[model samples]
Target: MKQDIDIPKVEGVYVAIVNEYNDIYKTQDWNAYIINDNDDALEMVIIVTDGYSEDKITSKFRKKIDVLPKKSYAKIELMQEELFAVNNQFKVTYFKGNTMYDKVYTFRKNTINLKALQPVPLMEARGVLVK
Candidate 1:
């Protein structure tokens, strides 16, 4: 009789850290479908929270961060010398490719915006990073 050799299991966790606007709890591709020329139909949502174990966060949200919508564009401002934790507070500014000429705004750390001020165009968003 042939027997399978059992290997020891190693416990671990997986994580991905993104600056400012994080789409870790959603699965919609809100970034790819919008055009910069239009701002009214902008239904962009963004979330920023303290980082956690991938398995834990995924299960709580019932989805993978990969399914989360990518930012159309992001303006990241590093808070400290390093980004050590998901909860580490940092300022962020973003644009969805339609409203306000793509000007970025500083949002409170550890929070999210279910919508943007407007849909901003890519071209308009390019030079509008107000820092």
Candidate 2:
């Protein structure tokens, strides 16, 4: 029964968009990252990301990470400036110990700008985070 199913609340994991300088390109770039702030390692992490709006939709990007250790972060992708006009989403799934956990993180249209950036947990840089 639906009421009998055990769905644990997801915590300590977050998706953030950070603005930083690129050494090779010599320009500031917008990038997405997955932060794991838990004490235990996450296994078989999968992320499906995309951006969309009523009139425009970006391509779907699927990323997989075999393992993400505690208190670490990984760069997911470099986001172009144009993509920020639409709503961006990251669907995340992973296993902690024997339990499976999942969550959807979304950045609303025009909300990924520098003005919205804040100190991201477990990361040194500041950026916008899905609340």
> What are the RMSD figures for all models against the true structure?
17.2, 1.4
Q: Compared to the true structure, candidate 2 yields what TM-score?
A: 0.94
TM-score of each: 0.18, 0.94
Per-residue lDDT for 6-93 in model 2, tens only?
A: 7588899999999999999899999999999999999999999999999998899999999999999999999999999999999999
Q: For candidate 1, what is the lDDT? A: 0.26
**Which segments of model 1 are wrong by more than 4 Å?**
1-42, 52-72, 85-131
lDDT of 1 by residue, 26-112 (tens): 442122112212222223323233323333221111111212133333322223312222233222212333321222123233322
CA-lDDT, candidates in order: 0.26, 0.93
Residue 20 displacement (Å), model 1: 14
Q: How many residue pairs clash in each candidate?
A: 14, 0
Clashing pairs in 2: none
